[model samples]
Target: MPATADFKFTASIDDSLSGSSCWSAPSNIALVKYWGKKENQIPANPSISFTLNQCKTITGIDFQPKKNTGQFSFDFLFEGQPKESFHPKIESFFQRIFPYCPYLSHFHFSIDSQNTFPHSSGIASSASGMAALSVNLMDLERQSNPSMSEEYFWQKASFLARLGSGSACRSLKGQVVVWGEHATIQGSTDLYGVEFPDEIHSNFNHYQDTILLVDKGEKQVSSTVGHDLMHNHPYATRRFEQAHDNLKAMQNVLTTGDLEQFIQLTESEALTLHAMMMTSMPYFILMKPNTLEIINKIWSFRRETKIPLCFTLDAGANVHVLYPENDKAAVLQFIQSELVGYCQKEQYICDEIGNGALKIQR
Candidate 1:
């Protein structure tokens, strides 16, 4: 039996909920490169993302649909927009995806979304967006599979969410998440997001990351395009190895509390990781002037003030400063007054390493 709603979208529901349950998933920054996925968007190997402290998305779902094919009908309220976009991509997803995932097709969604940070600041909003969507979508799943565990639901959701955005799979959980090694380069890879163990969570508490709004310009070589470059890259294997090694080393440092080692490995890995993209035949340069400037400043900080600020980049110009949380105060001031300089005031997103991703209300 399906329940239909005319107020939002009319569709079928086995049972009607009192209302809607809310969930929020925090945004994350890749301390290491999670680039280059295989077909179906699986990654070459496992990589991780840190659920950020600052950025996140909240979504609420009251699942009653306007139609009865048991299809995926969604009405989205994107952040701050006067009206819901009902973005074309989403509509198309319902039209196409419902056939395979029949349950989705029947229900229509009344989705409300808001971003804690700027939409396109290279902060990986898609990660949180899809995460929130999937988690919130679970309400529909739960209606039927009341016995299904939350973990199981999230695993399944991550798998589906990846088809929407690559980085999104990681946003299904908090603290730390990995798309695993099964993914292709563009994040198009199909891999379930896994939460880290409590020990790993405890170990990462002191880690620091600062998002630098470099040049604050457009993102070149969007993650998807970057993956395409990776597919055709001659040194793809080497780059993959580099990313894997970096991830392993990062995990070790977090586990062992090795700050110095973490800094050294992180900077080298970021350069080499992006270099693989730079040298690609089709050249994808996502780094803005401030990206390089911040890099140089970090280096100079090491030489002049003797700071231990290491840097990492994802698919965009925004640079993340990875350092020790204890040193965070000085880290923020140093970047604001010294490294960032007054010149680049136009582009500055000073924030520390944030917590892992989680649903908003849930």
Candidate 2:
């Protein structure tokens, strides 16, 4: 079911000429990965993710009505410097979502965005960045009409975020979020994601993600290219079926806090996501030598200590080590003593399931 709450507009931009909004949104690590996508950024299969804390993007947008009759224009900055590469993607996002915010084309947008973690380094930066932008757009809507319901506000933000980046919809809120329509989950739709309503044990609430950056370079194959390759993938049908089964099983695991099943399913999903890439029409491999080494060590460590520590990977070479809060000390000791060697310059980010996006005043 859609969430309902009051939206307190504590601050707003100047109403006469211009308005501005700022938001900080966290990136998410998918347990049931969203690999292939359809037209309009729809997911090929349902996926669930944990919204992470430390890794996030802060975005602020200043909007002003156009002085002349012309197409929408905007300037983008990443950490206060011109980012020409981001303009086309943002332009495409605006073009795709023009209907939802028709007034957008009539205004000029000044967007400034910055990330807490490295871009294209295995973490879902696009998810955080786009979701933050989506929230700001929603705030703009609220500025014009204060009567918008809270449920209506977030749903529209989630919907718009999905258009910018498919996985972004899941970055909205709740520790766990589900994207894509499912027969078993009610109120779940392809247009937007909804929170997982089942009982999540307290033990899993403080789950930590210790990321090991095996390679800091850009991915060999972009996620956009990889998603398109799925159209001609040999195992496309079976892959989708596997994802559906995994999602259903994960729901049970989450509710019961079955760490054993959680490790099995999550590891398999991570490997399967990369497997699809290797089998694509123009096959490509993203994992480096250290990436595999880290995975093997994680397995060995789990067997030696029986600490319930496991690993998963995003689209890049970085590895995300997931474990419960109860084992925080042991896990940190393990990472410092063992896993840190695999990371480039010993670089890694410690994160946890976060509370989604935040509105920044100013």
Candidate 3:
């Protein structure tokens, strides 16, 4: 309810408690991008996103009591192999959240995580990965505090996930999610995301997002670096204002099934994301030539076919081709015949609207 952690209660550590948790969380594509941020991982402007089905991360943690120490410890793995490189990030995340979950200090953790799509290929692995991890952490908490209500459980997970990655909070739900503080949306706050209240129109619900992996390689600039650049960006204020206004319009579009306005706002947000990057002080461009080609082709295809299909980009060169489910036959055909050539190794992930994170019983 508050914008930050209320810390209303804490779990008393039980030495006999030794359990594990696993969660599968779907990646999300932002229709309204949250670019800049403030301290505590709060977004500068509210954004909306669509949770995707195919691109996901499954993370499980095995925990047991540590002997004679209250220090945080974890062995992180990626795809079943030990990954020392991922340790620092996870360690950092643990440190940020350790205060709220002091029980973490009493256990050693073995984390196993894997992704269905390429990890850093602009598919939002952080959103899925961090959300999965956050849910698992809360699941662990529920073991000691079984009386916790379901609403508080998810709110805590979304809160913790945001501390790890700002957008990760949005990955906690399905169809559509909104993160960051907003003036119009009720219950919307900067601490965690809230799902859209209005019933999403069928046309927008179950929409398709065919990821065109123009470049599978990592970006020259990480999203962290990109966000920091906004601190001194000349257009930061204007961009933030635009995002707020766009989010308002987007709400109406989703509720009323205004596909034309949807396409316009989505594509504009995508291009604006890159435009910010290109205009940064130490300017850098993330969109490759093939990214441009795909964009142009998508525009031409839409013009020629009059389909409601449109494209959006993350911080990388990859393109997410979004359209209504009814248009999938034509859209997929267009991708197979025209857009596949631009992808690295013709690699693309077919994804659609999805329900948020799932807890694995095992």
Compared with the true structure, the alpha-carbon lDDT of candidate 1 equals: 0.65
Model 2, residue 323: distance off in Å is 0.2
Candidate 1: misplaced stretches above 4 Å?
1-18, 80-86, 92-100, 182-190, 201-203, 342-347, 350-362
Q: What's the lDDT for all of these models?
A: 0.65, 0.87, 0.88
Q: Residues 109-204, candidate 1, lDDT per residue (tens digit)?
A: 677887877765556677777777767666666666677666666666676567567777777665766566522322222366666543563535
Better of 2 and 3 by lDDT: 3
- In the range 23-103, model 3's lDDT, one tens digit per residue, is 998888899998889998989889999988878899999999888555778899899999998888898998898878888
Question: How many clashes does the backbone of model 1 have?
Answer: 43
Q: Roughly what TM-score does model 1 have, to 2 decimal places?
A: 0.84
In model 3, the Cα lDDT at residue 213 comes to 84
Worst 10 contiguous positions by lDDT, candidate 2: 3-12
- TM-scores for all predictions: 0.84, 0.94, 0.97
TM-score-superior candidate, 1 or 2:
2
Query: For residues 1-362, could you state the per-residue lDDT of candidate 2 as single tens digits?
Result: 44222222333334355778899998999999989999889889999999898899999999887765357789999999999999999999988777677667667889999999976566668899889999998888787768887877788888889989988998888789999887777678888888897879776987999999889887888999999999989999999999999999999999999999999999999999999999999999999999999999999999999999888888889999999998999999989998889999898888888879899998
| Clash count for each candidate, listed in order shown | 43, 0, 0
Pick out the ten consecutive residues of candidate 3 with the lowest summed lDDT: 2-11
